[model samples]
Target: MADRRLAIEAWESLFRAQHEVFEVLSNDFVGTDLSQAEYDVLLTVTRSPAMTARLRDVTANMLISQPSVSRLVDRMVGRGLVTKCNDPDDGRGALVTATDLGVRAFRAIGAAHGKRIAEQMSRLDDDELLALRALTEKLRAGVDVDEA
Candidate 1:
């Protein structure tokens, strides 16, 4: 019982720390005006090979609803950050691809975010950080994440 209590406390502490950090980062990114959802889509599209993805792919990758993804994509397209094309593989499917502007934005945001996260992680010793990674990976592996 004590062990379980300790574990739960550790988890809550981790979540609280993460939330605080994200809040700071989000504030720093306010003028850029990228919502968390838009950033997630940008990350997904930018990381994918050729910076291209189908609408369905975004829904699957982001674990978001199709309509939500569509609305986000539509906004992104209007901003000239992304473009929608007819999917070659599926005539009826719409393919989304990041534009040069999108890549530039992603690069800038990713650099700042990476630097902050790296600096925060540097507070931990190498061994402690590695142990945390191992434990988290083990916990994640135990979960049954549904793929769409």
Candidate 2:
């Protein structure tokens, strides 16, 4: 087993690094029409098949609460960035699809944001980036296992 002190230090380092990177990258959204949370939703929805996704899936991928995601989606709906409809397979479930406006907005921001992400991540060499991705995925897999 790893030493408790070492484990704690590693966890703190990971947390702090995430916060620092997020803080820096979040600046990419400063002048955008969408907030960070809204962008996250669009990113997921836009990447899904037919440019649509289940609301539950969106909530699952988000860092916020279910109710918070619901409210955010409602606001996005009002803005015509996305449209919500009842899931055909599940009467009680909702589906969200990006509007044409949403696609254009997301694509514009995504192109710029992608460049920013690449620039920010360029701090690490390729090998280091691969290692970091592996470590994070391992950590995430452990959490998934625990949930299962």
Candidate number of the best lDDT: 2
Task: Flag regions of model 1 displaced more than 4 Å.
Answer: 60-66, 90-94, 146-148
Model 1 per-residue lDDT tens digits across residues 2-36: 49989999989988987887787676467774666
Candidate 1 minimal-lDDT segment of 10 residues = 27-36
Could you give candidate 2's per-residue lDDT for residues 33-137 as a string of tens digits? 989999999999999999999999999899998899999999999999999999999998999999999998899899889998999899999999999999998
| Candidate 1 local Cα displacement, residue 66, angstroms | 4.6
Clashes of 2: 0
